[model samples]
Target: MVASVFSIYVRTVHRIWRQVKNSGMHVDVSHKRTGNCGRKRIQIDLTQFLEIPLRQWTTLDSLACSINMNKTTLFRRLKSGAIRRHSNAIKPILKEENKRSRFQFCISMLDESSIPQDPIFKGMYNIVHIDEKWFYMTKKI
Candidate 1:
């Protein structure tokens, strides 16, 4: 069945990832998987990318490629509010939920301390950068 194949594939990927880590091999993944498919010729603006997709594509990589801009440029536009999101880009759940919702849902985030951490780079991360002038270098190169 499909489930068994998926399980085997997941196991294979995990085993490979583990082996690569254990062997201290750093894989430099450079190329991306997808492109805008000739949309780059039209020079689609940021608004067109956001509006036509109707806010479905939330990732920065996709938005950047679709609008033919790099991630840094897209982030700069977003921070400067040059690009605006369409109205009701995210449609609400319901009118009743909007009208009569007395209390907001209380949510809790529990990160995976339970899941096994990566074995490689275990002890190397504990050392902090001990420069006093590290602040001026935060947003700069």
Candidate 2:
């Protein structure tokens, strides 16, 4: 049994030495297409692709597929301002009321004289409706 194992070990070492001598056998077999140099597909119409996003809030990749334009060209168009910024959605509301007086009342309670610095309130803290139990200090006019 030992003799057989020694024979196998000798055969394995011999095979390894033979393979090492043959350098081509160790070369990257997976890189069969290493020498291959193919023509690249050109991207077209970068301007159109770029403008679509700013005008419509969509991505260049998506817009390119839809209009059959190159993303690069679309970017150029956007840079030149061919595609403009979209119109704003927000509009200010004009309400008729004595807003200044209400603000003054709240400020007086905080005692701006004693407290030089004001704290920043979070979320809807300004529009609170407190009960009569929570009293605010106010001086006579």
lDDT of each: 0.51, 0.52
Q: On residues 1-141, what C-alpha lDDT tens digit does candidate 1 reach at each position?
A: 443765755565666677678877876423344673444432336456635452334456666665566878777676767764433323434666665543332111222353366322233345475766544422311
In model 2, what lDDT does residue 41 have? Answer: 38
What's the lDDT for residue 62 in model 2?
58
Cα displacement (angstroms), candidate 2, residue 1, comes to 96
> Across residues 17-97, which tens digit of lDDT does each residue of candidate 2 receive?
666678755743243465576754344554544555443334556565566767676677667676643433222232445
Off by over 4 Å in 1: 1-56, 87-104, 107-141
Each candidate structure's TM-score, on Cα atoms with residue i matched to residue i, is 0.28, 0.24
Worst 10 residues of 1 by lDDT: 102-111
> How far in Å is the alpha carbon of 12 misplaced in model 1?
73
